[model samples]
Target chain A: MNDTVLVLSIASAIVAGTPILLAALGEIITERSGVMNLGVEGMMLVGGVVGFWAGVNTGSLTLALFLGGMAGVALALVHAVLAVSLRVDQTVSGLSLVIVGGGLSAFLGSSGDPSLLQSPNGLDVNPLFPQSLRDLPAVGPIVFGHDIVVYLAMLATVGAAYFLYRTPSGLSLRAVGEDPAAADAAGLNVVRIRYLATAVGGLGAGVGGAYLTLAVLGTWQNGVTAGLGWIAVALVILAGWRPGLALLGAYVFGGLRGLSFTLQLAEVDVPSDFLAMIPFVAAFIVVVAVSANPKRARRVAAPAALAQPYSREAR
Target chain B: MSRISVEPRAHGGAHVHLGVPVASLAVALLVGAVILAVAGNSAFEAYRTMFDASLNGWTAFSRTLTLATPLILTGLAAAVAFRMKIYNIGGEGQLYLGAIVSSWLALALPADLPKPLMLLVFLVGGALAGAFWASLAAIPRAYLNADEIITTLMLNFIALSLMNYLIFGSMTFWRDPSRQVPGGKKIPESAQLPALSGRLHAGIIIAIVCAVVLWWVLRQTSWGFQLRTIGDSPAAARYAGMSVSLKVLSVLAISGALAGLAGAIEVSGVTKGLEPRSLATDIGFTGIIVAVIARTNPLGVVPVAVFLAAIATSGTALQGIGIQVEVVFLLQGLIFLSVTAGEFFVTNRVSLSRPASTSASGTSTPGSDTAPVVS
Candidate 1:
């Protein structure tokens, strides 16, 4: 491949991977706190559309990103109320959220001014580094040619890793996930901690959605996330609920995704449709491989009370 | 000091109230109305248009029935598996495989064969193909202890991609070359299901029969009892000598087969072949909503399927009048959310209670398993 093509492919992979990385990191925090919010896809969609709408109206990228994150938070709040407060089945709540978010986004995106769906200039984030640095040989394109979100995603990964492993609050979060009753006995305020974790997770997912609209596509469309959120969920499992590992998993999947487009661009004989199946198929394989040994699966990761509703009186 | 608490109803004493689901539906519709208003559309007129378009006339009603045909079978598919605590979310994928298999069978069969026999082959072939496809996920779930949710969901994408590959890319055996846009070859005329009414084919009968059979099997048969026992408590069922693994595999197979049947029926009865875009709608996903709203009761799936189908048909009709069809989805989502929330109230009773001793804060035992019933 030509240097320009290689540079573009690598750049595209980073851009594609950023959203998944952001969403997966949020899910890791949520799962680490013993709450399984499966509505990441729905949350992302709401974020994407709301963020896009904000961008079109306000013409401010920062406000668009903020609204996108808030949209995710709003959707997550519904999940928190249903799964956390009402003690509804986590799976059911998450699935419902997906339906709601997808439907709402589709309705809003299609019914409004047709022009808004096609943002003229697209929501491209300004590159973090100067043009001179970005144009510097092979190293520049790979390292300096990306927007601010890519950098933030890297920082978030490291920050999340430290927060999860090296901090006292992280220990308390793990304790609540492992044994809420014990955590409660230890004066951890289990409910409050869980609620906060879910909210923070929502914020991360929202930012991911904003990144999709403002950084990647720069336009709004119904189902624009295109199951990226679902892939993010699988990425979390593949990462074993560790934020840093999630970054790695996201990029790998992102590379595979980018490869599909790159191969199509290269006029490869393989069907692009079949190639498109790579990320999902890979996710399925990883999940099956990780879970093949039930004992090992239990021992390795997966928060014990991950989907279990917590009520002080339930036990 | 006062506190609020909830408790599960005593076994066998829980009253099955019709009010809960009804109230949930009412609330959902109210929410939909609010959404419509927010979108600058007349909520009442939109709903009226939907009802009139789908239910006002005999022809319109038949169209709704046609839409409900696949939903009924798919709903049964989800219902049966959910009863066994097996999450078979791969109905969409299974349906696609069923369509492909049934279409292949119909094409391969002698063109001069008797119509009834050809139809029978299509039905059986479709169900078997679906079962086979479901087994791919079921085996891993049963043996490897892999999470079925991820497996089933991932398989859905694979199945859809496989269908696309067959018609659009690799396999040209099923593709209709004459068409500008790629689509599967039409099934033999003999294999096509006869319409009982305007575009409402014999598949409706098959769907109803399956629902009844599933309901009977789940309620009266020993296998059904075993499945239910396992669903309620796997450890207890295992202690009672039930093969948990075997049951898991069988349940998923049955679930997949039912969903596959929906795909087959759609191909044979509705579309007469596959047009990938038309074939891959939200029917399978909607089946999940129907099953849930029906409370995983096979018999109850019939009405739920028709109700959802009516909404879908009406949504399409509204699209003709310049309204977006996504409102249907919004409503469906609202219904699902409200119904699930309603389930909490139905299963558990909540009430406020005052403490015997006056204190600034109520001393209520939270998360206590055997807290005294305040009533």
Candidate 2:
């Protein structure tokens, strides 16, 4: 590939990867707190629709993204009520959230300006760096030729890693996930921490969803997030619950997505439809390889209390 | 101080089984009504139309059964796998493979083939294809301890892409080249399932039979006992010398076959061709909802599937009354949520008590398995 093509691919990869990155970062925290929220897709859908609605009405990108995150938080609160408060099965609860979110978003988005479904580009985020910075040498476009969401995603990754590994509350959160009974005994409020983590995770997912409509696709459409939310859930497992690895994994998957377009552009022998399967297939292979070995699987296994609802009385 | 204490119940009585599901349906409708009211639609008017459209007439009920046919099989698939704590969410993909294979067999087999034989071939072919698709994830899960949740989900996407390629992108065997717009070749007339009533086909009978057979196996056979044993406690099953890995492979295969059968039935019963747009809907996911409301019981799956399908069948009618069709999805979600919450009542007994002393906090004997401290 030519240098410009490679640079453009890299930039696009960052853009495609940003949403997944943000969602995964949120999930890492949520999962670290020993709660698995499978409603990321649903959360994202709600986020995207709300964000698009806010952007259309107010014309403020920041408000759109913020409302999107709050929408996700709203869904996550329902999840908390079911999975944490009522102590229902977390997986089932998460699935229901997806259904509710999808239905709610679809209903809400159905009545909006009919023309928005055509994927217009008016809502797109502008690049943070000036054209001069983007026009510099080979590294210029690759590094600085991106929108603000891309930069924020990178910042979020660093923030996630630091919060997870450095902060005292982070340690408490990890402790809760690893051993909720012990965490409870240690005076950590397991329920409260889980609720907070799940909400934070929802916030991230909501922003990721908003980012898709606001920056990536630049329009509101039903099921626009597609399976990116599920991909984020898988990326969390593939990254072994680490923030840095999630960034790497998301970009790699995004790069594969970018390569498909590049290959189609170059008129490769393969069908475009088949090329679209690359990221999913790659995910399957890598996840299988990681989980194939019992030792490795155990090494990178989910937090011990991952999906188990905590009750002091039960212990 | 007053405190609410929750304790796990040893067993749920018969009332819990029958009442919870019925209660959940009512709760879902109530919640759905509230949502409609908030959305500025007349909840009662919309529901009245929904009830009349779905359950008021035999013709209407038949249409609901047509939608319920695939749901029954997929619900059984999910119910079986979920009972063993295996999340085979790829029923969507498995169903697709079933349709692909069954349609292929219909086209390749002799046109002069006997009707019953053709039907059997289609059904069996579809089941095998679904099992094959499921085995892709099942093998890794059984041997490597890979997470089937992710693998199965990934496979769903891959299966979708494969379907798109066959119908839209390539002039493969499944596509009809003669058509201006790309689509699946129509199956021979003899291959179509015989209709029992208005739009309802023999698939309903097949679905009910499978459910009955599954119920019998799970409740009676030694293999079923082993499977249940493994589901409840792997360590106990291991001590009893049961091969958990083998059961995993078989259970998932069985699950896949059921889902695939749904696909085959859909092709033979409704679409009569590999129509991507119609097939790409959320039937598989809806099956999960069916299984959940039924509490993963095979027999319960049938009625639950019908109930949900009734709502779905009325969705178009809902749109006629200025209600979005997505409200059906919203109702389903609400049902799932209420049912999940209702499980706490089934499994746990909660009571309110006041402390003897005037201390701010009420206390119970921690980790005590004794009787409830009623007050």
Interface RMSD in angstroms for candidate 1: 2.1
On residues B1-375, what C-alpha lDDT tens digit does candidate 2 reach at each position? 676666788898889777877888899899889888887889999999999889988988999989999999999999999889888899999999999999999999987799999999999999999999999999999998888988998998999999999999899998998999988999998789999987899999999999999999999999888878898898899898999999999999999999999999999999888987888887888888889889999999999999999999999998787777878877888888888778877888776755556675555565555334342
TM-score for chain A, prediction 2: 0.95
**Local error of candidate 1 at A212, Å?**
1.3
lDDT values, one for every candidate: 0.85, 0.88
| Residue lDDT tens for model 1, B26-99 | 99999999988888888888999999988889999999999999999999999999888787888988999999
Query: Comparing chain B with the reference, what is the TM-score for each candidate?
Result: 0.93, 0.94
Best candidate per lDDT, number? Answer: 2
Q: Supply candidate 2's per-residue lDDT for A2.
A: 24
